[model samples]
Target: MTLFTVDPATVTPAPFTDDDWAFTLLRCLASPSTEEYPPARLCGFLFLAPDRLRLYFGTEPDLPGTTAADVRPGGALTALLAALPSLLDEQRLTKTDTDDPHCSRVVDLTGW
Candidate 1:
């Protein structure tokens, strides 16, 4: 797993794991704070690229909770979340943080 670093010493860094990212994504999705993030919605779609990950929701499919009735077939992100916890490549989980305006913290788990 990779390690996350916070600007403030009081904040604990998140251990690099798919589960960690998934949880972060989940919390971000459920929150109403948009100032820190770019223009996007929670249900629109997820953009997972080599350099960045962003979730947008505008006319996009909303992610139902695991108990919801309309869960995606194969559980989509849910299934991914489950599978991600077991990822073996520890080095790949590294978090590359940058001051770039486009993406501040990008986790590149491409090969894994």
Candidate 2:
């Protein structure tokens, strides 16, 4: 068998306050199939901010869309690690990136 290793620089380091959002997202992407929800195949990108956390998945994911209540059971990762259950519960299921909200401003905390 061949072995491969990941370079540290390519990874997004977890913030000190929480365990690790990246790992949590990975787990959600690998969830096992269940009666209500099928196994997660492809996990969409993660958009994180102080006040909001959003997950975007396309229709090809084999998951249902947002319900009439404008709420759906978000991936387990957001619920478990985010801690802001209500705010993080909403996800944008879209197939195209054109509809995604553009980042007008970004703060660099790398030096902090």
Candidate 3:
């Protein structure tokens, strides 16, 4: 698993509310990447605390590994998020079907 710690102060508009945090997260995850290859697929949980936010990426259902800049909030964070989804694609990782119930349950829950 990979953990990304974000400093709230650096995030523009500063996520002060639950809704704001959700929106910021979605926006970052949906932002466009500046890469020519596809981004990696991220499957994990997001933990929001009173002081900061944590993005925990798991290595199941999909391969791991992602590249990011300094990840300063705002633009840099968005770029990093956008780049994650295309990592596996860029590496030409193949998606295989699984029969494990636990794995299937995870995939179903995450809709990955």
Candidate 4:
């Protein structure tokens, strides 16, 4: 299985809140496409974490290299939040006492 890990250090959590983080991956899943990304479909996970995440992507043929950067959050989560309410169940975040990590539900998007 391919692995796409997202370290909290990579994401500057200065904008959104921990509660609203779940929405980020959903955003990515809905419209996860950058200039370099191929027009392939994206489907993955919304793994919760107090800090980082692992966005697993299953790319189709003609596309080989898929990474965490390929996943989207804002738009994807919005759409999903509206549809899959059950996915938003409350879960304790994995916060480290040392540096108060951005406690939030993480999404691991795969294939977009």
Candidate 5:
């Protein structure tokens, strides 16, 4: 996997606090699907620091033998967000697993 760092200021809106930025990112990552765009299957995310976050995308569900692709260089947070849904729609990223908790547990962050 390719590791990179991004300044939170570039991706977040005004008020730029760490919690707010994280929330904004999570919301974007978990945005609902539309006819033109599919939902982003978020494997996970971690705040490495107040300014840095790491996001993981799951492997393509149809092609379990292939390694998951890395997020392309989008330069800004909005660009990254725009790219994600298409990636899932195109089968470059996995679909969200809504069944079979025994295979994997899904964490619901809405309550938090």
Candidate 6:
């Protein structure tokens, strides 16, 4: 019987705004029983102008390229939270960092 505790402030969702970029922290898990849905969760933050998104999954995350088309889905946290449903719909899955006990995930809100 263990309860998880992440600072409420850290988990808090940002407001939906036009200029916000979504920085999602996805933890991909493997299904043992071959479940169709698999197990996953979406944890992340949003960034506005003068702010940006940076993520570290032990390894560095891929920054957006020059093309906005490829960068839209991975925008600021505010934008991501607002369009979370759509990202899930498009990707057809969600992931959580809890799947791994030793995995350290860091999402940095920097330049936007």
lDDT agreement with native, every candidate = 0.38, 0.35, 0.37, 0.40, 0.48, 0.31
The deviation in Å at residue 85 for candidate 4 is: 28
lDDT of 4 by residue, 1-112 (tens): 9998999988877767644665555465556555555343344443435433444333445334332221233335555434332222212321123221222233233232
Best by TM-score: 5
Model 5 pairs in collision: none
Regions more than 4 Å wrong, model 5: 1-14, 33-40, 62-75, 85-112
TM-score of 6: 0.18
Candidate 5 lDDT over 1-112, as tens digits, reads 9989989878956655667666776776667445544334666665645655545555456333222223322236576566544443353233345353322323222211
Rate residue 90 of model 1 by lDDT.
29
Off by over 4 Å in 3: 1-19, 30-38, 58-112
lDDT of 6 by residue, 6-112 (tens): 89877878775434323122222111234554222323222323333322212223322110111232344345444433333232232233333333322222222
Top-lDDT candidate index:
5
Task: Say which prediction, candidate 4 or candidate 6, comes out ahead on TM-score.
Answer: 4
TM-score of 1: 0.25
Record all residue pairs in model 1 with backbone atoms less than 3 Å apart, i.e. clashing.
2-16, 41-57, 44-57
RMSD each, Å: 18.1, 12.0, 14.2, 18.9, 14.2, 14.9
C-alpha-based local distance difference test score of model 4: 0.40
Q: Which of candidates 1 and 6 is the stronger one according to lDDT? A: 1
Q: Write the per-residue lDDT of candidate 1 for residues 6-106, one digit (tens) a residue.
A: 67978887756654555565674557454664223344324343333443233112222211111111224544444432331223453335443343233
Query: Total clashing residue pairs per candidate?
Result: 3, 0, 8, 25, 0, 16
lDDT (10s digit) by residue, model 3, range 1-112: 9999999889877436654654576554544354443233233333334423333334433543322211223333444454544442332223234333222221111111
**C-alpha RMSD (angstroms) for model 6:** 14.9
